[model samples]
Target chain A: MEKETHQNIESIIEAGKMNELRKLLIGLSHEELERLQKLLNDPHEFSNEISSLLPYAIRKMVERGEISVDSLLPFVEESMHKSIQKNPQKLADILFPVMGPAIRKAVSEDLKRMIASINASLESGFSFRSLKWRLQAFTSRRSYAEIVMANSYLYHISNVFLIHKDSGILLHEASAPESKALEADLIASMLTAIRDFVQDSFSNAEKGTLDEIQFGSLKILIEQGPYAVLAVVAEGQPPADYRVTLMETIEAIHFNLGLELEKFDGDTEYFKLADKFLQQCLIKQKKEKKQKAPYQLIFLLLLLIAGVGYFVLINYENKANFKRFITELEATPGYHISSSRMSFNKIYLKGLVDPLAEPVEEIMKRFQKIEPGTLQASFEGYLSTEPEILQRRAGLLLSPPEGVEMKIENNRLIISGTAAADWEQNLELKIAAIAGITGFDISGLNKKITDLQWIIPSIERHRFLFDINVVKLDSLQQIQFDSLVQAAVFLDAYNQLYSRNMAIYVRSYTNRNGNVAANERVATARAEGFITLLENAGVKKALLKSQVLFAEDLRETVSLRTVHFSVFDNKPISR
Target chain B: MIKKKIAMLGAFAVGKTSLVQQYVHSIFSDKYQTTIGVKIDQKQITVADQDITLMLWDLYGDDDFMKMKPTYLIGASGYILVADGTRSETIEVALQLQEMAAATTNNAPFLLIINKSDLSETWEIAPETILRMQQKGWIVLLTSAKKNLMVEEAFQKLASLMLNPY
Candidate 1:
């Protein structure tokens, strides 16, 4: 009974302490008592309870605008990154349905832009406006295309780029038709680097920015945003509202793609949607100008065509003239063309020409196609066989004296009219030398035969009688001697004028009464004495020859012993 | 196509341009070296079946006229530190440029090239020094731009590293 009372006392004290704890917790709210009960139980039960109300609590926080999305953005990006890293193929599979159409649209758009630009360029070619633009380009030292763009448009946005601000990476690019495209990646990075360099050199980058970069007529307008930068490569001056457009574009990009920009890696596939916004910035306005006909181009074309046609006509005329000249040369007997050519509008001819043929210069004078100082000719002299040429040659060679006429008929030379004895003597020999004359006819010529023809025979028939061994001219008739000397001189003169060789021979005959040797000596002396007398009388000694002959007449006749005279021609006579 | 910006950093007259000329164009000129502040060149290479366009920024050597501009290396994906094998002091300048590159490019991938290896007989950099650099987890290659030795291999190696960074 005593031990039971002691135990009861300890239990009572414990109960009293619990009672005191229970009384201390009595003032707590029901939620506090339940939290304390849960704290004393399994830890998983607390998790389960919090999880059940977590969505509601977050909703309340978000609805009340008490939660900062910025604070949660990093976690969401990290989770998505982890998901993609876990299985990249899953994201790729999700995007596969739209990729084909997107790529096709991009390619078709590029092709269309190229075609349109090509058409525009072709249409503007050789136009008056294009010519003016070309002139402006030349004076200003700019490209024709650039000048055309500058003059045709009031302002043109050629290219637009959406670049990541921090990494200097190009996210998207847009351009107008035929805009000069550069390596956007490199340009973006270099642009960023240059901006950074300038900002670092001048002031902090956060305070101010590079608003514009002007080079010639091109202006690189930059609009900065929180995550991306919008750059416009504009030709000509853009209006103030253009900047407003850029600002709005950048703002829209940032607002729409804030989260994506924050988590942007090297993958730009998502930014491709930004092309539409960029394309909107590729704005252009044309300058109003009067439409004028391309008179200058038309005139230039007409001038070119006319010039070419004139050159062709002149060439054809020259060729025809050359052909006619060659025909004329071929037809004429004395002219033979070895070579004929035209160069630099000049005609050159090389041929053989007979001296008797018609002059080539005379033929050239007939055609105005041949210009003076533009004809070069080389010719070799030659004899011709034509009848006309032969007649002219015969006339030139014979050179008949006055009152003498010569003509060629049937390749035969016909002489008609009076001719001197020496002239007639040379006609037959000269006719043989002419190429085309078969023979000569002198039947119609009234031959003078000169007074020498009769005088020479009369002198030859009458010989001077010399004494048997006297060797003297004492018995010679003075009148007859003088007549003989006159006839000899006249014959020598005729021989010299007609290129003839004629001589008078004096023969002495000795009687048989003397010995043969004595007779020969007497005959030689008699002939030499006669020659001396003739030479002293003004007759040429060369015209007289001395000869000796012993008569075989035993009768010793006086006629045979007398000296004799004869005439002989030294040259062979053809007639 | 993936594009990466690479920077060439070195001391003056260290064969950086020569190595680039050899690797990119496979040509060499014996004319005197001309100083240029910066030059940009591009070449396409294939690594692991992926095409990559490398934009090479050949910066002026670190010297008094124009010290290395950190701004030039802002978007560089990798860099190559070139030093003349005949000059030991150039290694220090290359190291200094490497530090600047690291600071500006967030410690991007890089390679150390001891150039003019054809003149190894006249090298002032000892083998021990190169061994030290190698031991410090740096990829070092000996190249002779004059001989076209290891130029292609060096660029390809850097491209691969850039494509698949550690």
Candidate 2:
């Protein structure tokens, strides 16, 4: 009979007929129903066929509105036992659809009410215990009923309860058992809600208020929450203060819901006050914006008026001062005046001085007085004569121990002197610019003073053997003589009859055609004769001395005159 | 043509921004502006026959924030680790950045910029500190944004380091 009844029950379930299965079960004797219930409850004896029919039966009960907290309790307990006997995972899957939504709804409603009550209590100063009682009463009815109906519903439901508790909703003692089953789940869900709230509050909260709240605990939740919550919170405030606060709140909710409630109260009030403060700030910002507009306009208008006034005053003062300056300038001699405002004054004075016209130095001095502390002027203007300026500019070129002599003759400046330094070329350029000069005759200057010591040594060596002549010529003639004698003396000193191949010639001719005739032949002959005399003095044939001849116009003559000198070794005596 | 990567490293509260501002904008701000993440700026300079574009990255100095992976150090050719001359701890931070750079990448050339030299009496990091850094093979320089001292030279030295790696 039991086999037949089990077969019938299986058939009824297979046909998707829960009503038939109930009818079939009711028709059985009490003993048979007991036996079948036991068999169904025992998963080892209950075939997979029967277990499969269990979900259909429970779904039917739920659809028929017959699966109340009490009504579904037996089936849930039996199913749990059967699931444990067979496969716990399969049982969860089989039970999920029939009980998942209802449990989730019950828990979500319970948590929502709890959160609302907590938030209201915080805002309205309602007693936390009273709010806790009300939330417990509100949540327990559905939570207990669902827990009795489906033990698998405990996971999601527990999470909802804990989240509600974490949100400051107190849990009733009666619902605590179901909540304990959901410890991990509740902590996860609560952490998620807390993290979301803290993050949102942080991002949108009043700027200064967030600093007062602790976010350190929230990171604990981020580390310990469900995968979903962990993932989201990880992105939000990984280890930030908000995450820290969330973590602490979750821990408090788990270990002590009362403390969690207290913290929630504090956080909620803070958020509220921050919101009000932010609104007030927005209003103040609007006021400030409105107030700034007119002040800015007034400021701009004042600036414009000041600018116009300053320009007008500056122009008027400049005009009045220019008239006075023009009157004073007109009194000065050799002054040329030009002013744009003079036409307005109707004072057209020819040859009047231009007030702006002055030496650069005077202009710079006046500018310094007008604008004190101005940088030094870079203008290079001077009022001295060109020659003086040139001399000053050439100051760097003057070598030590050099003197210059200047003479003016026939509107031509003649500079005649010997310069003992190498910089005489540079000095000539300076002295050439003397005033009233048509041209400068600098040819009379000698760059070096002839050294007589060189001649003295040669004279000492050749004094007893030959007559050596030394002649000094005019400046122009001396230059020619120096050039000519330099090569001859160099050759003779090194190659000629050491001391005896020497003769000195000295002659000064008058400046006339007759003088040229008188001296030219002699100068030539003396040069040639010196060479011959060196040969006669037993000097080597290849080493002979010669003479240097200079030509100049004597003081009384307009024609060229000649002077000759014979150098032996370094000296010349009268020949 | 290798782009010059210039990293700006400094302690928690030094005027690295002031130095950068003085160099980049010729301006200074007395207020401290906290940085959260790395900021990037670019400047072009001509050095030794090459037109180098300096890619300057300004990194956060807060030690706690440094926990995040240092993605900013990648591809950096050179570094300018700035420290407050008035704070010795900042020199320590600069040295830390030097070690971080070495550990993260191969030993990249770097310049140790001791900022705020104008406040000489207030300087907590002594000249000996700079000499010590130099002894450790760091290119050290002293600068002052307030007086605009050696600010350009600091940047130029780091830029040159990119071309002639250490």
DockQ of each: 0.11, 0.00
- Among all windows of 10 consecutive residues in model 2 chain A, the one with the lowest summed lDDT is A280-289
Candidate 1 per-residue C-alpha lDDT over A1-575 given as tens digits, one digit per residue, 9 for 90 to 100: 99999999989998878767776878765567787897659688878888889999988987785775655788999998998999999988998999999999999999999997797778678678788888888998777777777877899998898987865777889988757667877777667766766776777446889989999788999999988889889988888898999999998788667788886644567888788889999998877666788999999999999999999998998888888878877787788889999888888889889988888888778777777688898999987877778878887888878888888888888989976666777667777987778887888998544556685686687777765766555534778788888778778766765667788888887656748787778788888888898889898887899988666643454465577788888993333
The TM-score values for the models, in the order shown, are 0.44, 0.23
In model 1, which runs have C-alpha deviations exceeding 4 angstroms?
A1-126, A134-145, A203-207, A259-265, A290-575, B32-37
lDDT values of the candidates?
0.82, 0.50
Show where candidate 2 strays beyond 4 Å. Answer: A1-575, B64-69
lDDT of 2 by residue, B12-57 (tens): 6677667777877789877888766655555667778877656566
**Tens-digit lDDT track of model 2 for A507-574:** 32232346666555655554555445444544444434343334353234322223334344435333
User: Which predicted model would earn the best lDDT?
Assistant: 1
